[model samples]
Target: MSIYLTAILKSKKDKIQDLKSILDNMVLNTKKEEACEKYELQQSLDDEAVFIFHEIWKSKEGLDAHNQQPYIQEFVEKVPDLLEKPAEIYLAKLV
Candidate 1:
């Protein structure tokens, strides 16, 4: 089964741009990773304060590798300070 994740982030008014910037960088870098099947950042059309990340990895190990990547760690650390609420990350297995 493929590994998938949906992450929701609600950015503070002042950090919306910063959140986008960071996510943009992470998306670009993620595409280069061996385990990344798909990595996308989406802005909420109805709510400008919301950002969504859709990610697909090759396997559980691949997802783990992605989590351990330095930039991923950095991105995770940066999100809390940039958001109005804590970011929510969901992990799923393709059926």
Candidate 2:
């Protein structure tokens, strides 16, 4: 079955622009993966520092492979310093 993910990220007040740039690059790179069905990056209008990623994968295994990608790893490693808090991730299935 396909897997869906919603990830919420909050950038440090001063680092919002930088985080946005990084996320843009991530989206560009991740969309090239074979099993990526959908990937979107959205920024909150109410709170510019808050961003969300909505992703759909062919399967859980595809999502797992995405996590291991170098761009994803780089994002993980760089986010701590730029983010206000840890990312909030939700995994879901169709009803």
Candidate 3:
């Protein structure tokens, strides 16, 4: 079965631009993955510091491989300095 993921990240008051750059890079690389059906990024109009990712993966194994990519690992390392809090992630079904 396909997997859908929604991830919301909030940047520190001063780190929105930096966070956006990283996320943009992620989009570029993620789009190259064979198993990524969708990997769209969005910013909230009401809260500029909030970033969201709407992603769909072909399988759990594909998503796991994605998490291990070097760029993604770098994001994990750098996020502590850029984010206001841990990311909010959800796995949901289309129903």
Candidate 3's C-alpha runs over 4 A off are none
Candidate 2 backbone collisions, by pair:
none
Q: How many backbone clashes does candidate 1 have?
A: 0
lDDT by residue for model 2 (1-91), tens: 9999999999999999999999999999999999999999999999999999999999989999999999899998999999999999999
The global C-alpha lDDT for each of the candidates, from Candidate 1 onward, is 0.88, 0.96, 0.96
TM-score for candidate 1, residues paired by index: 0.92
Please provide, for model 3 over 1-95, each residue's C-alpha lDDT reduced to its tens digit, 9 standing for 90 to 100.
Answer: 89999999999989999999999999999999988999999999999999999999999889999999999999999999999999999997678
Per lDDT, what order, best first? 3, 2, 1
Please provide, for model 1 over 1-95, each residue's C-alpha lDDT reduced to its tens digit, 9 standing for 90 to 100. 78999999999998888988888888888899998999988999998889999999899988888888888899878877999988898999856
Q: Which pairs clash in the backbone of model 1?
A: none
The 10-residue segment with the lowest total lDDT in model 1: 71-80
How accurate locally is residue 50 in candidate 2, as Cα lDDT from 0 to 100?
Answer: 98
Model 2, position 4, has a per-residue lDDT of 94
